[model samples]
Target: MNPQIPDGLRELLALAAGAGQAPWRTLLRPGDWLLLLCCAALVAASYPLLWRGGVADRAIVKRDGRLVTELALNVARKYEVTGAIGTTVIEVQPGRARVLSDPGPRQYCVQQGWLSRANAVAICAPNHVTLQLAGRGGAHADYDTINY
Candidate 1:
């Protein structure tokens, strides 16, 4: 007895065989070039806001279950948190933060590192602490805070 093949499978194989042809070159039209130029200009105009550290985003800090402070990020680095008696320095990095203090058994906050994106957060579940970033329009828009 001979094996039979499905018609759908045969059609797929034929399509794959036909797809092995050489790639084709594309020519950008004048309209396409104009669109590209416009996009580039817009990106260039927003570069300062997009790249400047801490100036475009807000930081929310919580300690001992209370809102301590909120500030704008001016640079990216390890943030050390102090002032909590009997506690160690809390280091914050991009996407994670860790506490060096052995306040308790869990050490969960030390496990979470720095957070980079706007509105993202890290929490010390053991200490009931949290650090969060502010999203667009959620941050204070005081003119004094803006860096020229």
Candidate 2:
């Protein structure tokens, strides 16, 4: 004997199997426009961060958890700092600073390239040297501290 299925359920299943997906416009509600606008606003709000990155005007060098030296930007100069292990060299320009040399085996800090924007940092764990940038508003550190 075969089991009997309800006629209404059978028709509904057949209709569902034959129908394709509905269009997105058909599924969208009027309130969804508010959500779309909010998303657009959020995207638009992030645009300024790109231009605000390079406004830093100070260079701070720290060694062995102590403030070694703090230099104001806008003038071109080079500064040398001694760490717990070895020596480090730092150079600053109008709006940027970078590590010229860091005594280390890996030379990772020396290879960090130019740091011309706010919050840029370079650290040499082998030599215990750090270079960081800041703005008048506050100091920005991507990595707070590293100990090796």
- The most accurate candidate by TM-score is 2
RMSD to the true structure for each prediction, in A, is 10.3, 6.3
Backbone-clash count (model 2):
0
Q: What's the C-alpha lDDT at position 102 in model 2?
A: 79
Name model 1 segments beyond 4 Å from true. 1-56, 76-85, 92-102, 139-148
Least accurate 10 contiguous residues by lDDT in model 2 = 139-148
Q: After the best TM-score superposition of candidate 1, give how far the Cα of residue 58 lies from its true spot, in angstroms.
A: 2.5
Write one digit per residue (lDDT tens) for candidate 1, span 45-88: 98867544333265676877677765556544444444343343
Q: 124 in model 2: Cα distance from truth in Å?
A: 1.2
Q: CA lDDT of 3 in candidate 1? A: 78
**TM-score of each predicted structure versus truth:** 0.40, 0.59
List lDDT for all candidates, in order: 0.56, 0.78
